[model samples]
Target: MRLTPDNDLTARAFARLDARLTRETERPVALALSGGGDSIALLRLATDWARARGRRVLALTIDHRLNVESGGWTAFAGEAARAAGANWRGLIWDGDKPQTGLTAAARAARHELIADAAREAGARVVLFAHTADDIAEADLMRAQGSTLGRVREWSPSPAWPQGRGLMLLRPLLGERRGVLRNWLAGQGADWIEDPANADPRFGRSRARQALAGAAPQAMDDARAQVGGRPTMDGEAMARVARDIGARTLAAALVCVGGGVTPPRGARLQGLTARLKAGEDFAATLCGARVEAASDGVRIMREAGELGRSGVVPLVLAPGVEAVWDGRFAFRAEQAGWSVVAARGRLASLSDADRAWINRLPAATRGAWPVLVRDAGLAPVLASEGIERRALVVERLRLALDETTHEDDLISATR
Candidate 1:
């Protein structure tokens, strides 16, 4: 579509964004604002749209506090947002620089800080002012093999909100930078350029400057090919993170939640199905894409120590524990699988006995059924010791009860 050469184009853009608000965010929306010409124009047009629909908008700005003029820029942005009838807030970031390089570190801080403000405002959908030009620049940079190149189509950046919980979005990714500038000029608005934007020392500055100095028609030609396409960088990263996090959570629950340890001993073959079904991440803490063999889990860790590969035969029974390679290992559980096993009584084993069999991970500790013979315990799955295997039947029922208890807890907590 040919955008009109007037403020009406901005109005049209806002109209399109408004239509997407429900899908992008909860009813009301939060816009990442920076009082720059591009954002100012968006704010003006979005205010009109919000008013028309009886909707509300929150404008978020982040202050890195690196420059003397940062304070002034933040205040100005807040005033403009208020003028546009949108709620506004500026989040401050003042911390010692870690090991990351200057620009890389600052961009990471800014994006995460802005997301925090958006969450505080109760916004489910976050909108950023990155226009089409930004996408072209980013795509070109990635193609050129810059450090910011994405490893996968969707994977979380090392940014926050992974633990913080936020669904980031960018609908204006389709607009051209020139169109926004031209349209903002139509409305008699002005903007200040960050002095760093002209600094040639940084690659992004150099890239933006290159685009600015290029022939207008060359940029126009580039825009024709890159017309209004959205950047899936952030969104894609979020999707991968969800998958990884879920996989990790499921693996962990097997250790601590169920009244059972993961498969151990001769049954290491049994866990083959469980771990593989859960993405094989349970045994492969390295995030390996391939399936983890028995060697991987058997070499997880030795109690407080790390685990090693090779052949390690583990027996699951009373008064015994084993630490595999990583957090992944199975405890000897002949007792937990039997009936006479009491969870409270089983947990009180002596330290000397535990050290002799220390590889036991806690996830499987509760599931191993042993005869609660006075406080100290021993495995009880043999037919010779007991007159009947009624104890075995009891242990199976307890395992079912334990599974039910864990399911209830997960549903309640979730």
Candidate 2:
């Protein structure tokens, strides 16, 4: 907690991130600047690193607008970014705030906004300032019965199609909050402290207070091997049936289902057991339809379940891009375009296209997403000035491979 700028600290931070940055092309590096001590330190370090390499830096701040001070924070972030000789953008989470689960909702909004902004800015990697203290706090929360997941030093962006091709880098994961704040203080830098960090109603804040007087436990490096192809045919399913676990199956369901959350643990376990038994069966979980037939086990987004799950067609303006059903990323080149499930519209496709669509599993064809024009035009099939990619399936396939790093997954998608 010494108030002295440690050159070793800067060197260490740069060392941790240099290799990762070097692997990217000449595109600008993006950072999520929250105006907090951790993110401010990241901005400073990343700016220095980028400047030395003659690269540009883009700092993005999300104005959740939940607090009266949010606007000021975004302004502060802009000023800070400019002072650091970096470009700045302010994104707003402008919508109705939920009455409950506000923290989770805010986090989701933050990720989506940041991912969209970073991708739009031509950045393939976004930097975050998660420190060792945050990891300890998460561990404590999990110990207290919270189902928090582990945070890695590098990972793909959590937001779906918006974060499709973006990788998240956490260079400060080995650093501590106090050390970062001390370094910022020594540099004569100031930052805004969000009151929410200390709000006791939040689990993170409570965990922080509880750990104030305790030492953090050493975290384990063990990881569950939950890898599989995006879609497994009957032969492939049988090949991995003996090795497939509930965690792996659940991930497939979530990925193919185009849903964010995974299925309940107990139900997932039951389904895993049934699938392992190697019997022909059909089941739906978390908005995904999983069927095991003579053809194989095909898991796909349940188009009929979308309305019940509150997923609506995505409306896109000209020159705009969006992800529909969290499965496909679509870019609209013409005006008045939208994306919807292709259930009843299969007949509108050309004969050749219909033949190709018919070859796919019968249950999956209906749930396939297709682009449409407002003028009662022919069904678009990733051609004719429209671009569509199944990025979710690609990510799932990469994620299921145990050897694939999150960084490699992003690069592969790009």
lDDT, residue 234, candidate 2: 26
Clashes of 2: 2
Best by TM-score: 2
Error of 2 at 378 (Å): 5.9
Question: Model 2, stretches more than 4 Å misplaced?
Answer: 1-7, 23-25, 219-224, 227-242, 277-280, 293-296, 310-316, 336-338, 347-351, 371-383, 397-414
Q: What's the true lDDT of residue 102 in model 1?
A: 76
lDDT of 1 by residue, 1-414 (tens): 344455457555665665445432234567778777678777777777777677788888878777899999999999988988998888887888665487877877777776666656656455666666665566566656664632211111123321022334444555667777777776677765678777888777777766663322212322122112111111000001211222232222222221122232333333334544543343332211122334332212111111122223233355443322212222333453233322343435556545533344443333333333333445332333322211211222222222221112111011
Tens-digit lDDT track for model 2 on 1-414?
A: 234456588899888877677543567888999999999999999998888777789999999989998889899999999999999999999979999988888998999999989988888788999988888999888878876667777666778767776778889988878788889988899999999889999999998887774555554442444544344442112123433666667667777777777675578888877777777887889888877666556676666787566667788777776777877777777778888777888999888878877776676677776767784887755567777666654656544543333245443221
Output the number of the lDDT-best candidate.
Answer: 2
**Residue 138 C-alpha lDDT in model 1:** 62
Candidate 1 lDDT: 0.46
Per-model tally of clashing residue pairs = 31, 2
- Local error of candidate 1 at 365, Å? 10
Model 1 lDDT, residue 64, Cα? 79
